[model samples]
Target: MSEGAFKKYGKRTLVYLFLILMSIISVFPLYWCFISSCNNTQQILGGRMVPSTHLIENLKNLFAQQDVLNAFKNSVINTVLVLVLSLAICSIAGYGFEIFHDKGKDAVMAVIMMSMMVPFVAILVPLFQMFTKMGFVNKYIGYILPSLSTPFLIMLFRNNARTFPKEVLEAARVDGLSEFGIFVRMFVPMMRPTFAAAATITFMNTWNAYLWPKVVLQTPDSITMPMLVANLLSGYVVDYGVVMAGVTICTLPTVIVFFILQKSFTEAVAGAVK
Candidate 1:
């Protein structure tokens, strides 16, 4: 090879090596958590990063706790509900903003964007008071209702919809399709990738949600995974093994969902760019 070509190849090889190292470093924590979850209390305390023979024991202990199962079920339900509701609502709103633009709609979009800038913590007190007054505390509706209209998700959908071909919608219109019909039949199928990306993100957010669930869900049965995990850690003597198990349980669903939808997630971003 020529000297210039050799030098360019060498630079690219070095960059690839650096990226591989960075990726390993980023994933090491998750690997360690998995290992720790399989370890016994003694192994964990000894700082062992390898799997121990205590995996069965840890599983037994986790399942022995009655509340753990209930918490797991509640978390699953909440996560699924939130994912479905948020995705549907956000996608529809996003499509509307992009496909049916008007002066009023533009103004509404601006307001939604501005709402995203408001710190969630800033509204917590008022939201709590409102929920309390409305008798929504300790209810599933309290948990789900507040998150149904996420501004960030709406923005994500709207931004993605910008890349959708206007001609496609026009053709649907020419074919005597109503706006809702076009959205349901044509737009949704075409936007699968974007929807997958949005679903993965929203599902993760809802699954890992802690503060809101903790505040709103007063009853043990209604508490989501993160809230349950927090409560487990709140005990005076924290059981690291049990806590790690809880963390794994709480994380597995989102991880599985992400892996399942990863192709769509990438395609969605690619479609948006196109």
Candidate 2:
């Protein structure tokens, strides 16, 4: 082969090799978790890489010993509430900021944007104190409140809203459609990709959330999936198989949701300005 052809093929081969290596690196932990879930503790501790016949036993222990089903229910409740309220609030806020076009609103948005720089951990203590005073602890509200309106989500919608054609709004207004009506009927349908993207992100984050829920949810009845996994990991004797089983269950929903919305997610995120 010519030197130029050799160089071109070499570069392509190198790129493919790098990607394959990264894919293995990324997928290894998940593979390990699944394998561990299907193995006895001894097999796991001995670094077993292959699947075993212990998955049913591990799952049986998980369901019998832990509140696996209850945790699933709690996680679903919190995730659904957060996803619905967050999307509604952030989308509307984003629509208003972009469509309204005023200096005062812009100033308010600047302040809100400034909040993105403040880590949630920095305000976690204050939030806990405030929620405690409000008697929100151990309640689904406590789990759902903090995430109902995030700045990043609002910004995402706002940037995408800017790309929405203003002519549609003008025509709707000329036809005497109310602003709320227009938003509900026109804006939402047109932004399915963005909404799908937002839903995927919100669902995953809320589903996998550990720390905030851990701080608020105290009762056994209110425990989430992550908390359930943590519980499996705890106690005087830890069962690796059971813990891995719990982890697999906890991780499954987010994985499913991502795969379902992945195409829209990639499109919307790519189209997001900045």
Q: Pick out the ten consecutive residues of candidate 2 with the lowest summed lDDT.
A: 264-273
Residue 53: error of model 1 in Å? 1.4
What TM-score fits each model?
Answer: 0.87, 0.94
Mind giving the per-residue lDDT tens digits that candidate 1 earns over 1-274? Answer: 6999999999999999999999999988777778888887778888897987767777677677638878888877887888888889989999899888999999999888889779888999999999999999988788888888987778778888887898998999999999999999998999887887877777777888888888889987888878877776676876678778878887777778778887765555454334
- Candidates' C-alpha lDDT: 0.82, 0.90
Residue range 1-274, candidate 2, lDDT tens digits: 6999999999999999999999999999998997789998899999999999999999999899988899899999999999899999999999999999699999999999999899889989999999999999999999999999988789889988997898999999999999999899999999988898888878878898989999999999999999989888667888899999999999877777677888866665664547
Q: Highest TM-score among the candidates is held by which one?
A: 2
Model 1 stretches astray by more than 4 angstroms: 1-20, 263-274
Model 2: CA > 4 A from native: 1-8, 267-273
Worst 10 residues of 1 by lDDT: 265-274
- TM-score for candidate 2: 0.94
